[model samples]
Target: MKESDILSEALVKIKNYIAANKDQDAPIVKFRTPADLDKIIHFTVDTAGVSENEFLDLLDKYLEYSVHTGNKQFLNQLYSGFNFPAFIGEIFSTLANTSMYTYEVAPVATSIEKEMIALMNSYTGYSDGDGIFVTGGSNANLIAMFSARNRILPDSRFEGYDRKVKLKAFVNEQAHYSFDTAANVLGIGSKNVVKVKSDVTGKMIPAELEKNILETIARNEKPFFVAATCATTLLGAYDPLDEIAAICKKYKLWLHADGSFGGSLILSDQYKALMKGIERTDSFAWNPHKLMNIPLICSALLVKKRGTLQHNITDINADYIFHDIDEIEDLGKKSIQCGRKVDAVKLWFAWKYFGLKNYQKRIDNLINMAIYAAKKISDHPQLEMLVPRQSFAVCFRYVPKFKTDLNQFNLDLREQLRKSGKSIVNYGYIRKSLAIRLVITNGELLEADMDLFFKNLLDAANNLESKCQLELEIH
Candidate 1:
């Protein structure tokens, strides 16, 4: 069979798998220990090519063991579902197999990336700002930190880490932990990445942020940056950007909004107020791969200051590779990576098909769905809300009114549901309380599914408790 024929057959199997998953015909994954997995699938190669028939057999086993993210029951992460337009763009870019380092070879890909970044900047209220697509949210955060460091201490780009500067980066207690890694990489100690306190809702309190800044200054630490999480991971709360921006202005600090989860809310006029005063921030990072339904690893770090990233990042001197062409058009020079993937095509194609209005409706629908789920839990006698609904992520717990250990009750409940293969909602500790973090992200997930999921969850909890009691009595 031709290669295309082989792939077509595989896609058919995948489609069937997705269709049957809703009816509980397949488990999310045929999970196994590594020792067992090695016995089932021929994973390692012995430096020899295999027959095409053998290849098909190996592919079947691999697919059977793999976890299906497109399945309706999948609610494990911040992202879910397969977008058709984005799928097409991904396939086309893979087939083209071009690097986006130079315009001489990748003119179309480079231009497409530039257009997408330009769009993000425009949405961010940057008149002549700049942005770039990065590998992930972590890298995007690093770019923001790097730019801020160089901008403030202009000589730090060339100077060694020993430069007479006490550099520090601040993040709300709820912010992503990437800044700690970034600080270590930039030669600043992890201790210098100060953790500011947040409110009960997981939002950065501006007064607390200013208090930390003043304390850091008193200790002679130069506070160059502060990252405000637009939407926290577990609670889904947003920091008050309008108040935080005022602090940054007062202290001459670089304010960065890490909107990896809630940034897409900007598309919806109604929800965009969550990011009020965003335009005033020095830098912003957003991941379409999360809420916007793009493929994984599609993140953009936008800046209000034009040419700032390029100036801070670009280290030029190679005449053979980077010739003196229209330098502004050369994107690779501005980025920290040399051969960036053609990551923009998927986002651009998805945007064209969905349009701004549809994206707005999609965002609204997510929030609405999460709200509905929260209500179902609240009304049910078996479950209780842990955190109020704010974004798509609803943090709730299963409670069976007899005053049992709620934490262990939730832990066992999560495992029982996962082992049964009926659903996939992971648990976490939010504010010292165990919570089932359900993000209403799958496009196919509906109200009926939510109702059934909750029912099954309660049934599993009761069944597990009965089993435990019977074992104890017998002993």
Candidate 2:
């Protein structure tokens, strides 16, 4: 068979996978144990290459077992659903197979990356800011911390840290684990990464942040970085950015906002207030892949100050790859990675297709859907909401009329739903209660989809109780 035939077969398989997910009767996943899946797939590579037919067969098997994240019922993580224009852009990027290092090779992609960064900066009130597409939110956060470290200790980049002075970073207790990883990557021991206290709602308390900064100073440690979370993982809580900024300003600390999960809220006129003081932040990490539904790994680290990235990460003296080009400089000068992927095209395609206004409308609809789901869970007789709805994550759990361990019951219910392939929602612990975390990141989610999830969840619970030989009495 020709190469075109192979491409056609692959596209057909992808098309079928996408269409299958839209059907309400279709399972979000074909449940498979790790051992069972290993036995089913031919994992070993032989000495000879396989034929086109065999390759197509392998592709079919891969698609058949993979979880259908495009399904509207998929609320398993921070991201779900799919964008057609972005998917096409992903295909185009793969077809080109060019590195995003220099404008000489990837002129259009470089331009797109710059324009995308400028557009994203405008939303954060960064009129003269600069940014680069990164691997993910974690790397973005790491870069933010790295920038802070270099700004204060510029000599540290060349000659290691001054052992006499202890450096410290701060983040909300509810912030993503990336901050801890960031500290470790920067060689600033993780123990020195202070965690400020937060309110019961999971928002960082400004007063506690100030107290921590003062304590760090009293201990003779240099407090240089403070990170405020736009939306946390478990509760979807947005830290008060304006207040945090004020504290950071008072301490002269570099303030970075991690909006990886809920950063797209800036597009919504109604919800943008969640990140009100984003303009004052020194750096901001936003992931279009999460809430914007662009595609995976579409994350950007936007620095308010122009040339901040280049200043922080200067390229080594390598004349071979770095050419003094006309007017435009290579993107590699500002990036940590030499051979970056063209992540901007997918985002640009999705943004162009939807436009800013339509994107806002979609985000507003998602927030409304979250509210709707929260109300449904709260009103249900057999369900109990673990926490008040914050942003998109609605925490709730099923409560049977029988005396049993609520935590274990919810765990079993989640597993049953997963194994049955009816619905694929995630679960997390809120304090001590294990709550079902229904994340509303899918822009295509509708009321009917939400209802169907509830229906499947209740049916799964009833079936589970029946199988356990325990009568579930309606409370």
Candidate 3:
């Protein structure tokens, strides 16, 4: 078969896959156990290459089994929905298959990344800012801590980590687990990353933070970096950045804001107050892949000071790849990676298609939908609101009429919904109760969709309760 013919066939399959995903009746995921899937799909990698017809059949099977994350019902993860322009950019970048380390190899992509960093910096209030596209939110947090470590203890980079002197960092107890991984990776010790206290709403208490700092200092330990979570993973809580910044300033510590989940709120005039003191932060981590509806792996770490990344990350001996050129800007100097993906192109394309006005509208709409979901849960007698809605995550659970284990019921209900392909919402614990975590990250999601999800959830609960009752009677 001709190359053109094969390409055309693949495109046709892609179109069909996308169309099926958008269908309201279609399942978000055709759930299957690993053993069942392994038995069904051909996983063998033979020495011989397959024919074009066989290859096309394989593509069909792949699309048939894969989870449709772009579906409207997909609310299981932080990221959901799809953007066509960004999809095109993803395809083009993959086709080019070039590294973003040098200007010569990826001139247009390099320039586009720089533009994206600048654009993100403007919202961060980093007038003289610098940034680089990283792998994910976790990687962004890791790099943030790494940058802080290098800046605070410059000797550690060259002379190696001084085990004699203990260094401590702090974050809210509700903060992402990535910080622990970061501490471990940087040799800071996971235990040294103190978990500051948070209030009922989940925001870190400034007084508690200061108390922890004082305690660490009393132990004669060096308190270097403090991370203020912009929006926590489960609760979607935003820590008080202004208050945290004041404490960090007094202690002369590097304050970094982890805005990986809620950074898109910076585009909204009304909602941006959640990160009011973002400009005061030394560094900010933003993931456009999350609420912005961009493709995955589209995250950036923006530093307030210019040239900080290059100074901290770049090696003096890598002359083979990085020539001492004054005019050209090579991104490798700023990145922790040697050969990074062109993550910015997809984000840039999405931004261009939506523009600032439409993007702001999207953010506003999603938040509104979240609020709507919260109110719906509150009004329903059967539904119990586990925690107040903060940003886009609504934590709640269904309350049955008869006496039974609420936690187990909610757990089974969530799994049943997923298995039946009715919905794909997630769950997280709110103290003792397991609340269903309905994240409103998809821009295309509507109020009606929210209603439908609740309806399906209630229906699942009814059927489950009936089956359990019948089993009990039989026993």
Candidate 4:
């Protein structure tokens, strides 16, 4: 077969896999350690490349061992499923093989990326503001942090942090770890990233934020930034944005909304209320790969002021490559890195394919799914919720009878589900206790899926409990 035939076969296999999530026999993830995977697929280079048939065989083996993220049973991460239209656009972009940094290289892709940023900014209330797409949510937050650093202490960009001021920042205790990473990367140190107290629901308490800022100031530290989480990772809670905005305004701090996990609330009329006062933020990070259901690595950083992202104002021309043109058309300036991918095309095409109304409905449906799961968890005698449901993730724990060390037993149950290829979920300790975090990110998930999740969970618990009791009997 020709290479085209092989490509066609591979694409068809992928398309079928994307649509075959409902297949019960389909594995969520095939368990293999590093040693096992290394044995299955050797990575040593070959001077003479493998033939088309060999490549096809390798693809088959790769798919057999890979985690099926689009599978209905898969509920392990912030992004759960696939978007077909977005995937098609991604394939097109991949074939186009163009970078989006400059119009000279990829005019159409650069245009789409700018236009997509404009669309996102329109909703974000950035009047004359601008935005750029980073590789992922983490980088989006980091860029926002740098922008804040540059704008807050304008001299720091030139003189560096030496002898200027003790720069400090704030985020809720439950905010993404990217904030700590940002602080460390910016030379502010993670210790300078003051973690304000969060409420029982994992929402950052605005009053506590004010108190922390006061304490930091008392210690002669300048608090320059505050990040309000839209949906925390574990609890999926939205921090009180209105209260935080007031505090930011009083302190003259840069307010950033880390909306990577829950920013689609902007599209929903009813659900967007969770993110009320979001427009007042100085910068915002939203990941379409998450709630927007776009493909991976589509994240945007939006700034309230248009020119805040301009790091270098000196006119240094590269006439041989890029002429002085519409700066708006050339996104390479706003970006932190060169040779950026055409990440916006897939998201723009996906947004246009779904339109605003349908997308809003999808967000509403996802929120409803979380509510449904929360109700199920509440009603089930064998399950216990760790916190109130604030967004599309329901964090809970399996309650076993006789009250043995439930965390380990629950972990065993999760392993059973994994081994059986019946369902996939995640568990970790939150608030010094083990909890299962299930995010409702799959657009195709239904009440029936929730039922299946609960059923499998119950069966696993029963079996594990029986084994434990048998062990006790032997002892």
How many steric clashes between backbone atoms does each model show? 0, 0, 0, 0
lDDT of each: 0.83, 0.90, 0.90, 0.85
Candidate 4 displacement at residue 142 in angstroms? 1.2
**Once superposed on the true structure, which residue ranges of model 2 sit more than 4 Å away at CA?**
468-475
User: How many backbone clashes are present in model 2?
Assistant: 0
Candidate 2 per-residue C-alpha lDDT over 179-208 given as tens digits, one digit per residue, 9 for 90 to 100: 999888888888889999989889999998
Listed per candidate, the RMSD to the true structure in angstroms reads: 1.9, 1.9, 1.1, 1.7
Clashing pairs in 4: none
Model 4 lDDT, residue 73, Cα: 80
lDDT of 4: 0.85
The residue pairs in collision within model 1 are none
Clashing pairs in 2: none
Worst 10 residues of 2 by lDDT: 466-475
Ranking by TM-score: 3, 2, 4, 1
Greater-lDDT candidate between 1 and 4? 4
Cα lDDT for residue 146, model 3?
88
- Tens-place lDDT digits, model 3, residues 1-475: 9889999999999898779767878887788888888887777877897888988888888888888888888889899998888999999999999999999889999999999999999899999999999999899889888888988888777777887678899999999999999999989889989999999889999999999999989999999999999889899999999999999999999999999998889999978999999999999989999999888889999999998888776355777888857699999878878889999999999999989999999999889999999999989999988878989899999888777899998999999999988689999998998999999999988888888888888899999989878877898
Candidate number with the higher lDDT (3 or 4): 3
State residue 325's C-alpha deviation in candidate 1, in Å: 3.7
Model 1 stretches astray by more than 4 angstroms? 1-4, 14-25, 326-328, 472-475
